[model samples]
Target: MRVLLAGGGTAGHTSPLLATAAVLAEAGDDITCLGTPKGLEVTLIPEAGFPLELVPPVPLPRRPNADLVRLPANLRRTVKATLGVIDRVRPDVVVGFGGYVSVPAYLAARRRKLPIVVHEGNALPGVANKLGARLTTHVAVSFPDTDLRGATYTGLPIRRQIADLDRDALRDEGRRYFGLDADRPTILVTGGSQGARRINTTMAAASRDLAAAGVQVLHAAGRPEEVELDRRAGDPPYVVERYIDRIDLAYAAADLVVCRSGANTVTEVAAVGLPAVFVPLPIGNGEQALNAHPVVGAGGGLLVEDAAFTPAWVDSAVVPLVTSPERLAHMSRAASGIVRRDAAEQLAQLIHRAAQERR
Candidate 1:
């Protein structure tokens, strides 16, 4: 099979795109990607060893403005560029995860009458996927309640490492690797690849309290020097790092997690069976909060506002929870129950069905 997958900018879009691409590649499919030079896909797609076709990003501005006035011409130019790429790649099917570049790719694929698969990762569909879904019957979504036409609840496709993770089996090695005490309850704190300033600061502030309660913290602070732990002597329970390359290890070591509620994060955490205190990004379409809803509503996790996720809340709520092994175990079971582990395979089958239709 030959495929052209489109998505970029944020990790939320790119992660699922790559997850599906990996599955297709394993089945001997030739995969190509469409993205913009400015987007993260420039680095990520190539690193995954797939051919990436670059296109100019055409962003549809909100509200009436000069940019909105230029939308038609910009969209036309991008669609034309995308058409050229489509002609050369001649993919049997095009799969798109919502992003700025996806709009043109979807439009071009629609014009070519190619099978187009649209994956919306958020509980609320984005404009690009929403537009694309109007033209195709293959629409896959992460959350069950996503309002999209012809949508299938495929869940979020996480990386292979996350999908295959065995936290109980890897706990000792993961804790030892991170210099955390194996006997103590460990909490992993992260704000994603770029990091969340609010989450970082709050986690740092709560580290001392976390240590005092005989709990260990593995904090991924994100930036170069965002978190600096002050330890008097021996190994403090709180360990801080700028970023974590091996998040599987983090998941293995963590009994609980404190992080943002992006679709990828929520899905990954739940997949690993780690109960989480989700702090959704305050800005943007309120999708982050919605992304956490199903998991939290399922008794798998707890959702808190960014502003309310203070050190005091950590002392009051988090400390109590982690100390209670029975409660943590119950929540862990709930979290794991919410994951559809076959999501990557499910999406791969959808792509295969769509691609097969062209033949």
Candidate 2:
């Protein structure tokens, strides 16, 4: 089977597509990725040894004036590019993970009469997924209560490297790799792959407080800020980086996590059974807040509003959890309950079924 996976813009959007593609590849499907040239997908897709077809960047305009100016041209380009790729690949199915790029890919799939699947990884449906859902043959979701109706709750598809880690070995390796004193509690702070400036500042200010309390920190400060953070927070008690390629190690070592509430991050935290304090990004139609509700509601994590986020709040909320083993254990159990490890398998099965039916 030939499958075309489409998504881009950020790691949050493309990671799940890569995860699903991995499963399909393992199942003997020839997988290709269609993505915007400058998006993370360009680097990530090629790094994974998958064939990546780059199209022009078609960023959705948020402002009225910009939308009026660019919409027609972007739409035309998107349609043309998508159609050209579809005709060339002749894929059996096109699976979209949700982003602006996914919109045209889905449309092209429909035009070709190929099976299309949309996987929404947010509690609220993204604009692209909302459009795709209407025409898609199957909708897979990360969160169970996502806005897209008629979607199966397949959880978020995480990369196999993280998914297949041996739990006990991961824990031991993580502790040693980060040079954490086995007796000290570890707290991981990340603002997604890009890093949140606010979160980074707050965590940096509170680093001393964390260290004074005998807590170790693994901070992913995004690309530009990683060096600054490393210079600011030196030594074994604080390990800082711009991006975490080995997230399994970070997740395994962390007793608690403070991060943004991107859908993929939330699900991955739950899958790894780590307690978290989620500070959703305060933008883009309040979607991140919606993503955090389920995890917060399940007692797996705390949802800290971006405006309410402060070093004190981080200290207050996280310090107690880290200090109390019982609380940490309960939160871990709650987090574990929120994810299904077979999410990718479930989504792949649905796609296969849909493709067969289409045939």
Candidate 3:
């Protein structure tokens, strides 16, 4: 089977797209990806060893303005480019992961009368995906309750490492790899690729208290220079890194995680059965809060608003949670079956079924 997948912009959309692509390729499907030049996909798709097709991105303006006036023309141009890609590739099916590029891909696939599969990664559906949902019967969402035209509760596709991880088995090696103490409780903090200023500062502010509680922190602060921790010679190691290339190790080392609730972040953390403190990004239509809600409701995690996740709250809530073995174990167990383990393989099967149906 030949599959053309459309997704890009950030890791939220790209990670799942790539994960599914990996499974499809291993099963002997020819995989091609569609993306906009402006998005991270310009490099990411090619780096993942897939053929990438570029189309102009149609960024819908929120307010009525010059961009809004130019929207139709821009969309038409992108749709034409996408159509050209589709004709040349001649895919059995077109799969869309919601992003600016997906709108054009969905429109083009329909114009060609091709089989289309749409995947929505957020709790709240995006406009591109909403439009795609109407065009096809196969619509899959990351969260269970995401309302769309024809929604199926296919869990978010995640990396192979996370899907196969056994935290208990790797804990000792992970601790040694990060140079963390064998006896101390470990917490991991991250705010995705670009990092979060609030999380970085607040975690730094509460570092002393956390250290005093005999806990270790693996803080992957997006911006290292901005988030400075006043470290003493013998404080429980508050190790900071700009980014973590190998997040599997980080998960193995952590009993708890404090991070943003992006779709990819939430799904990956939950899939690994890590207890979490999900601080949803204060902006953006409240989707992050919605993304973390199910886990929080299931007792797998706690959700905190950006404005309220202060150093004081960390001392009160986070410090105690890390020290309590019983609560951590409970949260870990709760987080364990929320995200399906074989989502990448499941999504691959769905894509193949869609392709075979078209025949």
Best by lDDT: 3
lDDT string for model 3 (273-355, tens) is 99999999999889999999989999999999999999999999999999999999999999987988888887887887888
Task: Provide the global lDDT of candidate 1 against the true structure.
Answer: 0.90
Q: Rate the local accuracy (lDDT) of all candidates.
A: 0.90, 0.83, 0.92
Reference-based TM-score, model 3? 0.98
Query: Who is ahead in TM-score, 2 or 3?
Result: 3
In candidate 2 the C-alpha lDDT for residue 176 amounts to 84
Mark the regions of model 2 whose C-alpha exceeds 4 Å error after superposition. 223-236
- How many Å off is the CA of 265 in candidate 1? 0.6
lDDT of 2: 0.83
Q: Pick the candidate with the highest TM-score.
A: 3
Candidate 2 vs candidate 3: which has greater lDDT?
A: 3
Show model 1 residue runs off by greater than 4 Å. 228-230
Clashing pairs in 1: none
